[model samples]
Target: MKFTTYLRQGAPRLAVVDGGDLIDLNDADAQVPADMRAALRAGADLQAAGRRAIQAGKRQALDGTKLAPLVPEPGKIICLGLNYYDHAKEGGREKPDYPWFFFRAASSLVAHGEAGWLPRVSSRFDYEAELAVVIGTAVPRHTTQADALGHVFGYACFNDMSVRDYQKRTPQWTIGKNFDRTGGFGPVLVTADELAPGATGLRIQSRLNGQVMQDANTDDMIFSVAETIALLAEVLTLEPGDVIVMGTPAGVGQARTPPVWMKAGDTIEIDIERVGLLSNPIANEAA
Candidate 1:
């Protein structure tokens, strides 16, 4: 089942995509949470409720509905860097035995169709297309990589926008990666069962305007979802609504001949096989 979050009466409301329409889960059944986070925490019971709602056949046209970040406020927005070998080689970085993790704040999230700000202080905005995993179950420490993927709920396309200057100012990438509205989170979340295990072997790409800029397959990731989860679980409990942005590929604008950067009025899009498309417009922060 495909799930999405949109605004209803000024607050986030969870919906299940049925063909070209969306069924508002809350309206269909009160047992279904009104938001994605709550539904995730509700676990299997919520899934059953959503299935029942679909059976009831109450749905609204999906076109142009206002959307909210898929998770709105993920407890942790963890990201991987240089998770693709080609991307690592292109960026002049060596492959590490461990995943390079970073965090993006909830404040930086912008949903699909929303405007992502081009910060006034920098013109070096670059796009990194990635596959983001949403955790559904709480994972305990010492979980094996083999068992780690069972904790995932679903997957979504993500564009991890970055401000180059600030990212280079310090060894830590938090400043550069945390610019408000830089994280393009979703259009819809495709349940884990709908895709190949660990979401590997899927094609992922990014488009600038209508032109394709980054293209690669999820199979290229250096750290698989299960491995990354196990690695992360060692450090902290992976809880429901926590997200893991499985790093981008080799075609980012930063590696271009003279470099390419996003500016006002540009549209950036991320398309991951099975996950769905996530697109956003760029606007000047001051505007």
Candidate 2:
């Protein structure tokens, strides 16, 4: 089942998407949490409740609804760098034996239909189309790859926007990546069961102002979802509501001839086959 988190009276509400309508799950069953993170923490029982709501609850028009970031506030937002071969080559880097992990603060996330801030201090912002995984269960430390899939709840499309100037100021990427509202996170969350095992072999792309900037397949990823999780679990527990953004493919604005940074008024889109499309307008960060 597809799930969406949208705003009602400026507060987030969890709903199940059904044929152009949204069924508010919490309204259908008070037992279900109104937040996606909370609901997922509630476990499989909440999934059953969502299914029942799709059949018996009232439906609300999905159009004109204001969306919220899929998780709103993920405890840990881990990202991979140079996980795609061509992407590494574009930046004059080698395919590494281990995943290059980075973290993004919760304040950086911007929901679909909202604007992605282009910091006034820099115009070197770039777009990265990536597949983001939403962890559903708490993974025990040292879990195996075989058991990692059980911890995933769903998948979503993500635009891992970058502030190139700040990113290059230091070797660590956290400062540049944590610019408020730079990460475009969701429109809908497609459960893991809805796609192929590990979400492999799917096409993912990024478009800027209607032109395709990046086009590649998930098959190009150096590390698959299960492998990444297993590796992560070996060090720390993967808790529910945590997000893992698989790295992007080659065609980013930074690697292009003469560069192509996003400016105010440009719109960026991330389309991940079978997951969903996430679109966000570019806007200058308010002074």
Candidate 3:
């Protein structure tokens, strides 16, 4: 089932997506938490709750609803760089043996339809369309690939926006990747049951102001979600609400002949077939 976190009275409220409407999960079942992160942590059968909500909950029109990040306050937000072969080649790098793991602070999260800030510090703002994995169960160190996916809860589209200058200033890409409100993170969350295992084979694309910029399939990723989870679990505990953003494909602004940076008033969209679409407007950070 598709789920979303929308704003009501300036507070985030979880809902199950229905035809042209949203069913308030908490309103349907007092047992269900209003927050996505809390619901994941609570370990309730969200799909079941969502189904119940869709059948007999408070219904509200979904059109033009303001949103919040899928997991508004994720426990951990891990990301990978150059996880796609074409993307690696475009950046003049060889295929990586291990995923270039990075962390994004919760503050970097921008909900779908929100403005993606173009920092005043530099003009190299760019976009990277990525697949976001939301952890459902704790994955302990040394978890095997076979068992890795079992811990995943759902998937969402993410725009891993970048400030290229800040990214290259240091060896670590976190500087540019962690800009507040740069990470576009929602629209809807599709439970793992609704898609292929590990969410492979789905088409992923990015469009800037109605023009396609990046296009690829999830199968193109060098590090599969299960593999990434196992590898990451080896380093640290992957808890509920922890997010793993599988890297982007080729066609990022920096790879173009004339780098295409996101400017104010531009709308950037990340669309993952079967998962969802995450769209955000570009705006000046200093404004």
1-287, model 3: which lDDT tens digit per residue? 88899998999999999878999899899998899889888898898898888878888887799989989999899999999999999999999999998899999999988899989898899999999999988898999999999999899999999999999999988998998899999899889988999999999999999999999999999999999999997889999999999999999999998889999999999999988878899999955
Looking at model 2, residue 179 earns an lDDT score of: 96
Global CA lDDT computed for model 2: 0.92
lDDT (tens digit, per residue) of candidate 2 on 1-287: 78989998999898999879999999999988899888877774556877899889999888778999988989899999999999999999999899999999889999999999989899999999999999998999999999999888889999999999999999988888989999999999998988988899899999999999999999999999999999998899988899999999999999989999999999999999988899999999988
Q: How many residue-pair clashes does candidate 3 contain? A: 0
Worst 10 residues of 1 by lDDT: 41-50
User: What residue pairs are clashing in model 2?
Assistant: none
lDDT of 1 by residue, 151-224 (tens): 89889999899999999999989899999999999999999989999998899999999999988999999999
C-alpha RMSD by candidate, in order: 1.1, 0.9, 0.9
Model 2 / residue 86 / CA error / Å: 0.7
TM-score per model over all chains: 0.98, 0.98, 0.98
Predicted structure 3, TM vs. truth: 0.98
Task: Report the alpha-carbon TM-score of model 1 versus the true structure.
Answer: 0.98
Alpha-carbon error at 154 in model 3, in Å? Answer: 0.7
CA lDDT of each prediction against the hidden true structure: 0.91, 0.92, 0.93
Q: Candidate 2: where are CA atoms >4 Å away?
A: none
